[model samples]
Target: MDLCFIVILLTFDVKSAPNPVNIAYTSVALSLHTDLVYMESPPGLQLLHCLRFDDCVEGGESTYLDLFHVVEEFRKSHPRYFQILSTIPATFHKCHYDRENPYHLVYQKPHIILNHRKQVVGLNWAPPFEGPLLVEEDDVLMYYEAYEELAKAIKNSDKILTYGMKVGDLMIFNNHRVLHGRNEFKLNDGIRHLQGCYIGIDDFKCKVQVLSNQVGDGQPPKHVGNQSWL
Candidate 1:
């Protein structure tokens, strides 16, 4: 089935349950993660538009990290852990509850996804949706060590960018290459609202190619096709 584009309003919902089913609905601080990592093919592009913002709010700054840069540094400092994560597949799962449209999603993939040349290209690192370890009992500890190390690297890395979005601000990013999250804010402090949607990378590329062809002098760019799509 084709993926659907979702436009959602993000705000603290006091009445919503504080479970994984609706963690985003709460005002708690969220860790860096890629959205829908449990899906076989997660959304490639995400667009967030801030509809309203309270100038008096104390926190809720947005955060982002480029996984590609993190992987490069990880390969140098912790080669063994990098190898293990890139080679072994881990479990990710989620269940949606709607009596009329209940569904369960599960996917198995390595924390670091490699291209045909064995080069790191993408990653799936949503800790909140991570399922139980499927590795052998003996290797469980080893995996956890690697997992913890990677998580620390991501959290403490100086490469992370932080910003406070304002009303009418729009941010577009590649979901496969970037991990995003937000800090906690007091709900009683003020109001905040954001609308977002996702789009497939393939469709986005096609549109770009068509536009480039129309504008270019009938010559494909030299860098075209040099990079492979994940």
Candidate 2:
């Protein structure tokens, strides 16, 4: 019964996926509200850390990678079914205007690429996009609450496979429908370290949005061009 409700709220149509799971513009405003509210939710404290590209450690947080500690911390809020992947490979997938056509070997940022073209290497300016979004990878634990929320949200998705979390904090989930990711990241500080730990996505209801809401919500802000499919 609850599953059906979540499916309705998240997918709108039983046979489709949420057009924009992240919930941009309209949701952006909601996100600010949600962030404030979620932050106030004590248990949700460790759920996420929305930081800029410059606050984390260098080497994309990889150098300071510490999954064990993160897992231990997550266990305080959620302890149950969870997996941990020791290491995951990083990709050079850029998230800028040129992201659609990725250059595996060539860096994506204009400044970085230009300097590299002129033979200036080792200069690491933060990657172009703000940060990676939700997705998943292998061997990571999901937090109980987040795990529950994601499970309820993605009960119907298939093509998406797993969700690689954006570049900020780790994604804690249930492992079933709540998939996780290591994400392609670059350093803004010391190193880029992302971790995960989860239990399930059961308790939380999917207040996300349904399909009817998706088509409407997916529509870009009025200011954009006729083709607001961004």
Q: How many clashing residue pairs are found in candidate 1? A: 0
Cα lDDT tens digits, model 1, 23-114, are 77666888999988888888877888887778876677889988878888998999999988987778999877753567699887889876
RMSD of each: 4.9, 23.3
lDDT for every model?
0.76, 0.25
Identify the leading candidate in terms of TM-score: 1
- Residue 229 Cα positional deviation in candidate 1, in Å, after optimal superposition: 4.9
Model 1 TM-score on a 0 to 1 scale? 0.82
> How well does candidate 1 score on lDDT at residue 115?
73
Error of 1 at 78 (Å): 1.1
Task: Please give the distance, in angstroms, between residue 210's alpha carbon in candidate 2 and its true position after superposition.
Answer: 20
lDDT by residue (tens digit), candidate 2, 9-115: 22111111235332221111110011111111112111333233344522222111222223334334433322211111112232334444443222222111112
Stretches off by above 4 angstroms in model 1 are 1-21, 96-101, 211-230
Provide the lDDT at 207 for model 1: 58
